[model samples]
Target: MLFVAAMLAARPGLSQQASLEEKWRALFAQTSPAAAEEHIDAVLAACGDSPAALRKLFACDSAYPQLGGGLHRRATTVVDGETRYDVEYVVRVPGGYSPVRSCALLLAAHGQGGSGASITAMMQRGLGAEVEKYIIVAPTLPGPRRYAGAAYQEQAYLKPLAWARLNLNVDDDRIYVSGHSLGGHCTWHLATMFPHLFAAAVPMAGVPLFEGSPYTSNSYLENLANLPVWAIWGELDQKGPGTLSNVHFCRMAAERLRQLGNSKFEGTELPGVGHAGWWPKPEAYARYLTSHKRLAAPEKLVHFFHRARHGRAYYVEAIRLARDELDFSRRPQPKLRVQPGESLAEAAIRTGKQVYDKSLFKIWADLDKGANAMSIRASGVSAVRVYATEGMFDLSRPVTLRFAGRSWTGGISASARCMLTHYAATRDATAVICNEVDVDSAGKVLVRFGPSGGGETAE
Candidate 1:
């Protein structure tokens, strides 16, 4: 009789959980960021505002389809500008895949003339015995061989990763990305833009956009300071007669990596290898990929970005960039006429100002939980957001932030809304924070909350 009564009492709780799960499904389905934020706020209002309670409610796992582990080709919708189309990707699940045991996930991309199947086969060949332990997903480029664009990045690369996280028992800490040739270029860009998503990156024979027509000479190589990067290229690889050799770019990246104190990065220039049809030892590559795990909360983060969408790394997010610093139109035109005594090289330097400085945003931050304080240095950005967890800040006491020759000390209140906001954006539970504070360059708090019932903001 008592057991029966207990079951009856638990019925309402079970129903509530199911309802919350349904809401979470819908929340993740929302495409627009603003729409997602609205949904999150609504859910917080309907549910309680306690982050612990909400996190527990949102932690429930869903049922997976019974597709007995193997290579499965799946089609996801891709939208590029006005056109929306279906693109296929290949996912290889080990035969031993089980929901009970989490497995590492490898997101690989293919170069031009290569399909998803080809990259899967390539990884399988490269991984050899190690392949069986990983769930590999390879997405073909939707149209051109460019992974730099939105369609390829959002739909082709990240969507499949989201799908795997939702459906499979993926170990978030062990996720890695790798590619070859054009895919290698994609790997470099993805690693630079989304360093938070992977444990390490293996970019094979790809060029980092340093000295190019489209991109300026300045590089975002500092962003890779925390990410473990293994870039391999042939010493003999050259793009064309007038273009610089692949080795030159690789050496430049290596130099930058050294300057940034990135011991994890390795740029390999094989003696006789060329741009195509060759790779370093597969076993060695596999060893490097499996060696590192994702750092959920790093003590420091050095991030640089050209686009607002790619402004976040670790706990620091650039909300608004300084327009005057990033606007090419505001820059003075290059000197067309050279002085009579000036050399040709001097004239070239005067007239040639090829850089993406106008759009670049720089953020450097160090979190000291022991001191309950954070120190930040920012450039080319007017506003920034700091998402703080227990690992980053002591929520119970007043948190101090020193930035731009000013210090702001305030008590940080934990909120479910803040947690859900990040969770909704990342879909990664590790990124969910206990509290968040937005401040402009002058260290004025723009928006910050205090206790659940005391949300505060400043104009």
Candidate 2:
């Protein structure tokens, strides 16, 4: 067609990328899983380890004529240390797409035992009219696995996002994430672990805080205080005897957000509907998602971590957690019960013993009062950084950092240096100003001091 020819001619040197993408799709479609994986390995072997080469091989740009609309199969290599393998994903580019203008991107995760193709089809129908306005991406897990675990999140979700940022005309401010059932749980994990990356999120019929799950005690709900979240559930959607019901999880999450003063969180309970109701009414979820945009930085941030698996959130970076904090987080809380005549004070004391020291290494920062300050009762934390002028701190003024019974002072020069280091690690162009400081590893680190006349030094 003339349209296809014009598109190919407009983007020079795109033919090879298009060819590779087509071959990958054909191979995936025609061959058995084992044969397809073998062919993928061979194709990726030819591309080598060069970032530029890999990008081109994956068709990271909008050069493929078939990508303008409908589902398109693409392959990319996910490198985990020395090991590397090719993975497949499906992307649906809205009709009438233009390279000059960036459009919203919806990262949809499929349910258990589902592939990118099936998920993409479901989303197209579920999202209804909203599908016409955005680009939808669905990633298939390797092999025949249904559950999305930590490995899949890194390989399928995060890697694809990095690729999309480089290749597609994506509006960074409008990137959204959503999922159903098992995918919904993955949605919660992804959104909470990396709240800064998403504008909004919708998790349907999934419970991230069920007993025996790794996320049970390590619910990073506070990290999502600034992100808009819409959680959906059915009253009768309990999957099994030991499983936590979606309704209970969503209600508890909503209540927790409310207690934290987060106004952007909402929980929608579908009456008389079961776990599968959300797929039939995609427009309902779309309504909550379309108008929201990501705030690259917020004035206040709270982040909790169980381990070093996740280190950064918005403007706050956790260098490390104290040994005691990690230990306490892992320890089970005592179940307290009040006697028949027990006073409220007595009950409080019993409960406090179990949960009082839970936040020993928690991080909290606030800049609404027009000063750069933070607080952390952390012991053995090597370093922590409070980004300046990323809407979290005022770099023009002096900073007063107080922690572990010590006070540190720094000026604009120190803030600038810290900002540069943060920019280097994250490569986030939006962060104009940021700062970092090493904490005393012996005791608590609390930012509760006055300004210093020096340029940049912790004294």
Candidate 3:
């Protein structure tokens, strides 16, 4: 209703007003600048007093249409009760946008307390389309959010990223992520969180991952090493660099992944890239993304995107269930179905960053093409849920549920010996259940989640 006025308007004056400016500009070839100004004045009067109508006199584009080649829109995505930001992005594809592959996704998150304006400043200073080669997404930021730890990236960059792909012809196989300072730290988490999602990651002058820092574990880096990584920081960065956290973390991470038999990862330490100086990310990060495909699957990439957009709860649980081999000897054939219109041919499974999960099920997610139906087999619990949808997952509501009725009272007890050989069910009281089930790993589930009987827990 707020925009109803513009929606109902005739918009007839736009064409007439636009041509008037064209005629005026043409006159500039033969007449004086004074004459052009006179015509401009005439054009304005013909258009009218309304702002939208008047813009036509100058041949200006409406707010949403880019003046040259970019996207422009303003929407309020309220995060916390007290915080709100203007999420903005500018899409510019030189030739045209494509999707089966994936256009690059760049998240320009800022350091602690820096406004979204500062992030935009960095992008404009050196990150415009000059030599850029990917789609850029700059999420709105609070002036005080930390680059490394502001939970904002998950909310801003991650979710909108899913929405972004919906409208643009983005390459599904190549979404990339980046940031600076605090953003650098956040970028680290992004790379680690769903290591398989990004083709590459670039964090500039980011605060280093200090020794013993809870978030600096090797698990994340191990996950990230599947692809190329480029890091930059000023020699003078004092926040965490005085301690060499930024430079050394990369060193330690590279070494750890190598020890783990990962040889595809690369790390760069700029001799002079400063802690907060404007960075040439388009140049460096661009090279990283185009260099090589990190050797993963499209399903993994889409799953990564799904996790980023949706919360990781279900995604994490699914990852534990994705592999063909579980810690227990029994291998369940249960598969996870992505919502309709998701990608296919998923990537290989990779490790993800870890913290603490007090819940019985540590929910996890990754894109999977090989999985026919996704299910879980745990120490005390086992479950499954099919997405029932197709390729190119939509994580906004990325899940569905399925349940079966069998009353033996309590399901898998915390002490029950439950293993999914292919399917699992139990019909007797006080026992691990493996009732009427087919344990089809390659069978597609029609929903995303299943049942919770007595003593059954999935949260």
Candidate 4:
């Protein structure tokens, strides 16, 4: 509450801006998603009518609350079968931490049978003195085996990261995720599904491909095009019956990345090293993690996804994909292997239905904000939402969108609806969008506007 009071006292001048600030405070103060969304309506109402003004207001980054430094154990609420429970996580705030200086965040997930406390302790040991440059967060990932999937994404990762952003001075561009073994698998999952949220990913001794339900990392290789991946594993880990070894998967990933035109991936295989590979020393680890920063608004983006929920890469999102079951989940089928004497085409024809790539969706988008023009190439995707922020382009100019050989060139007005709705959904004020343009596969253009404005369409 004192932090809220400080924010109120810091800005005293105009009543309008002050009113919006109060609304923001009220919005962030809500603990639950439903409450937060309900509060967004009030915030939108307080913004009057201008989308540009709303963008400016929301662009004001909130100051980090005065939270003393230390390892703090926090709990986030989660729901299951109409019942709710609390999930615990550990956050390591560097000694002598100050709200004035922004620091990198490291999401250290633990392996099977390990808890958040153990992972946090391991990070403290590994990072040593260099840990002072980061705020390390370790969540006791949910599920009996502490699996890394959609549930972990929401409860363990997203919730904790949201808390850190609101309460700590976290550098959005310097965030990193790393894990070992099962945690390493989680690291790969997080990096593949949410590359936009991380600058780099370090996965030690874990392969994304494992026999399991809900598929593995093979289908999402293109998503790693821009994210720097440092995959380290023992050459002898998990090599046996029903296993293809971590080194094998890492090598395959490197090859796939190359095929995807990605040169940002690196795979290091240690001789004789087993499942528990190794971690870089404190100084080296810090230097590697801090050397890279996330590209907030890349001019070009490539993303491939099996589920539409993970379709967001950066400025482009596949809001509506061509797939019937966007949230499909099932045990993965065996790959269509080419028989000893069968031709590759023959093998595909025989078991092509078991192939993963055939069912995937992809979107390639290039933005030329200077010309106010953007082009998109999509496959198995029905519709996309393109976000426009002041950081990406000048919203004051006419924006042109081209898809499927059709082009629409018109001025796009910032919409309060788009701004508020996006903020409510993401809770990320750093990349809050001013406006969004929704386009369909057939070249239909829908520029979303708030209550004060009307929808505009172009062929």
Candidate 5:
């Protein structure tokens, strides 16, 4: 790993007061555009000073409506039991000090050969000072950005945000996050490990979620219901192994979020760009920062829709993939409509429940003009628990419902609700009620129920 060693050696030589922005530019010239961002992030990590010293030296112009930012270095204490290292961070605060205002935070973790420097540079110049209205903290991640303990490294950085604020005046509501490569890996760790922490995330060219629990990490990952995230990848980048289901991971993640009724989930596969394309489109990501909004970036809506739709579709497909008997078979070109926020998973969990916001579903019963339909079968349900709004209920069209009874016939019909449920899965198909309807049989005879009232009939 001499290559890795040389990159880490580039650090100690970095001046404590080297220009964060200038170094970023030079890094761009010295390294491939892809590695430059991480390198710059590395420089930032090496520039740590004591917290008290930083408080005095940390200076900036007042954050204007969209004009504010500068190089700020600070070292905060990180305590994990008795051992504590001075974790450094370079911040680009959007605006200057003002009255109490809500803030969004973008916590950038550096990859191997990089530190807070490049991450800091990215926050300042790439996204610009107008982005400073919110605080962007880039921490110097450990071990030259190694994968081992990355999840803990992420959690280590995030824990102090609240604790640091307990002594300061940091706002807790508007934190947003993202990272690239190894840092992106850390971002994934942080987001899922603590999904309750962010509004949205955009992970660029990082590893897909792996099961880190049982052996090392404390737990395994379930489909998250509270967080909405967007993942990004370069189609050709293999240095970080971006080819392994990275796009599919984001797509599936978006689908899961949709199942939670959150249509805001997003992911994008940036064509032709590799791991280092952050510079070319950094501005496109500026708005998700929670403090600044870039009106000029067009990709915002485009990426948003891509992930949302893919996420919605995936959640719907998962039920069939679960293959709960019904002798399920695949169909070509299944027509499933998308309700506003319904991710594939969120929709499936809502079957047979009350819906306050009808906007969050792709109920097969809702299609007015579509000519095709879907069918399902169920056996038994130990406990048909509705999915908690803050719980997993990913659903979409062509959904499969599980209930009790001998496959009933006679043109029966039903719809989905925003409510989610957990039908204790088993090998026996005789537990829960299953939805069964074919394309031609879809619109003809309809029986349904509503939140306002309930009635059953044959259409």
Candidate 6:
């Protein structure tokens, strides 16, 4: 009897029960569908009948089918603060799609006032045979707002991507993003804001928004230095005054990419075409998209954002923004002085009134294992704060930061309580690690550690 019981306990599926319980605990701690989906299959197979609460925990009744490729309309409930939204998305799978084989995924964003159904129909018409080769996902935007702001990127684009990754056998190296018109603007924004998520980007008849301007500036274009960006625009397309022509903007963005030493950037201007011309040429877009694959780990990354919510780039995560408001003059500059034996609580009270101008940024690498140093440069910014982690450098060994004929060498360290406090306030998990330093008056800030370990971690 004992031998028989041991055999049953040693079964492959039964052994996963404990892991399932641990995953459920983590899932409930952060109420996200993506987290739940990570271990859903294993949990369902291992303890589906044993735990009555497991079904309720994941709302498993609403789970969609994972097999048989076709058009699938799925709705997910997303909660932000006190409000809950029933977000719906359309996923079209090729007839040949198989659970055993991974397929390329394309996230298609619709134009203003358009639904996922409409964009899927457009793709069906335009892509023809190419549509069957990839899994396409289109998400509906909430209300009448177009893909004009960060809200659309967060709710519409990112939510659908997360859903597809969880539900489908998506090729992580082949994931791509594309959009037309207003969606095109969002494509640029998403590509820059989260470059690591995409292998390539296609922005057609759209302009990137930057600093209250319709078109992306040269300074902001540096964020896409490591991305393979292909932009398309109609030569005859025009917006109101103070806005540059879409064709001109694409050309300028491509030139900026080239100036930054990116060789994969390309811009195409369609002559004798209007705002809606690119819709019929999905073959061209497909060819470009298929030629590129995502670089899972890159040697260097650069990202800049005005808000803490948009802080993540490829390998670096922004813990805090330079200032909440774009105007630097309005930001409070705190004066620091130690009077005759002031209490710590009093110093904290005084500092709390002042603006925390010290923005924090962190990079994950195992530099101690190799000998190659990472180089970085930024313009049109006051100062940059950088932290190296994941054993990127020997904390005890001296690391040098050189810029503008000046250099600073020191062992980097930060208070764990300070990092945790900032994360508690901003809800940014990436800021919890330590080893931080700040570079003042940044022009070209170079960090000479050692070679990289070539391992990848989240930004």
TM-score of 6: 0.62
lDDT of residue 10 for candidate 2: 36
Whichever of 2 and 3 has more lDDT, that candidate is 2
lDDT per model vs. reference: 0.71, 0.59, 0.41, 0.71, 0.40, 0.57
Candidate 4: stretches off by over 4 Å:
1-12, 15-23, 32-64, 79-86, 146-155, 209-216, 239-242, 326-354, 415-430, 450-459
Q: Model 5: per-residue lDDT, tens digit, 150-229?
A: 32464456744543232222344456677777766667666654554455666677654432211111111232334556
Tell me the tens digit of each residue's lDDT in model 1 across 415-458.
77767775655445555577778888665784455664455664
The Cα RMSD of model 4 versus the native structure comes to 4.5
Clashing pairs in 6: 370-451, 371-450, 371-451, 372-450, 372-451
lDDT of 5 at 169: 25
- Off by more than 4 A, model 3: 1-68, 71-73, 80-104, 112-121, 124-132, 148-152, 207-219, 225-227, 234-236, 241-244, 272-274, 278-284, 293-459
Name the 10 consecutive residues with the lowest summed lDDT in model 1: 1-10
lDDT of 3 by residue, 283-306 (tens): 554566566543432233212211
**Clashes in predicted model 1:** 1
Task: Report how far off residue 233 is in candidate 6 (Å).
Answer: 1.0
TM-score for candidate 5, please give it.
0.44
lDDT score for candidate 1 against the true structure: 0.71
Candidate 2's error at 100, in angstroms?
2.5
Order of candidates by TM-score, top first?
A: 4, 1, 2, 6, 3, 5
TM-score of each: 0.81, 0.68, 0.49, 0.83, 0.44, 0.62
Task: Give per-residue lDDT, candidate 6, residue 272.
Answer: 85
lDDT tens digits, residues 1-459, model 6? Answer: 222232234333434335544443343334343334444444344443222233122222112235677888977765555666677899998899864456788888787777888878877776778988889999887754545454544666687777676556567678888888777777887787778778898877886654334322343565676789888888888841134566656666676677888876787888888788456466776788889987644666666555555565554444433344344334343565656775443344234223322332223222222532334344333445555532455555666554333555554533332232232222222223333444544333433222131221111
Clashes of each: 1, 8, 67, 0, 63, 5
**Worst window of 10 by summed lDDT in candidate 5:** 420-429
